[model samples]
Target: MDVDGEERIAAPREVVWHALNDPEILRQCIPGCQSLEKTSPTELVTTVRIKIGPVGATFNGEITLSNINAPESYTISGEGKGGIAGFGKGAADVVLIEDGDETILRYAAKAQVGGKLAQLGSRLIDSASRKLAQQFFADFNAAVAADGQT
Candidate 1:
């Protein structure tokens, strides 16, 4: 599945960029995230719990950042294994554009799933994916805006 969207954050591009790279910030913004740890400058390990349809699973994943251009754009990719529930892998190209005092964050993403997740049907998976992405961005926006105010 493919998803594309943008968010206007009430912070500068540099602040948004730093927040995006901060594992603590990411853990707070990502729905269902149990833990997120940065193991390297360009990599992180994460655990998240999620339910798709009737299947609930805990996913352990490694996320990598590539093609990075500081305060500008990068490609973020990851693969998660959920035991029998399924496996999910996806990549997103994210860009941070300056919009006066705020930042316009844009992303284009593609994802694939296997095992029980794929058996659940594309429509359900797509809807769930979109919802999760929206929730993440909303949380991220709030977190960054609040930080800027402090």
Candidate 2:
């Protein structure tokens, strides 16, 4: 599956960039994220719970950031196993553009699933993925806005 979208944040590009790289911020923004720990500057260990169709599982994963260009852009990739529920792996390219005082964040991602998740059908998985992505950006925008006001 392929998913891509853009969001406009009411903050400076630098601030948006910082939030994107911050594990605490990501932990709060990611839907069903149980934990996200930075194992290294470019790697993170994560646990997330997800429910799709009739399958619910907790996935342990490692997310890696590469081709990083600081406050501009980077590529992130990860894979997780959800026991018998299945497995998922994906990669995303994220870019940040400064629009005066605001920031425009854009991403293009590709994902694949195997096992029970794939059996659930592409429509269901795509819908769930899109909803999760939207929720993450909404939460992230709110968090960044709140932080700026403080």
Model 1 Cα lDDT, one tens digit per residue, 13-120: 999999999999999999999999999999999999999999899999999999999989999999999999999999999999999999999999999999999999
Q: Show model 1 residue runs off by greater than 4 Å.
A: none
TM-score of each: 0.99, 0.98
Writing each residue's lDDT as its tens digit, candidate 2 over 1-150 gives 999999999999999989888999999999999999999999999999999979899999999999999899999999999999999999999999999999999999999999999999999999999999999999999999987788
Q: Judge candidate 1 against the unseen true structure and give its global Cα lDDT, from 0 to 1.
A: 0.96
Number of the predicted model whose TM-score against the real structure is largest = 1
- Candidate 2 lDDT trough over 10 residues, lowest sum: 141-150
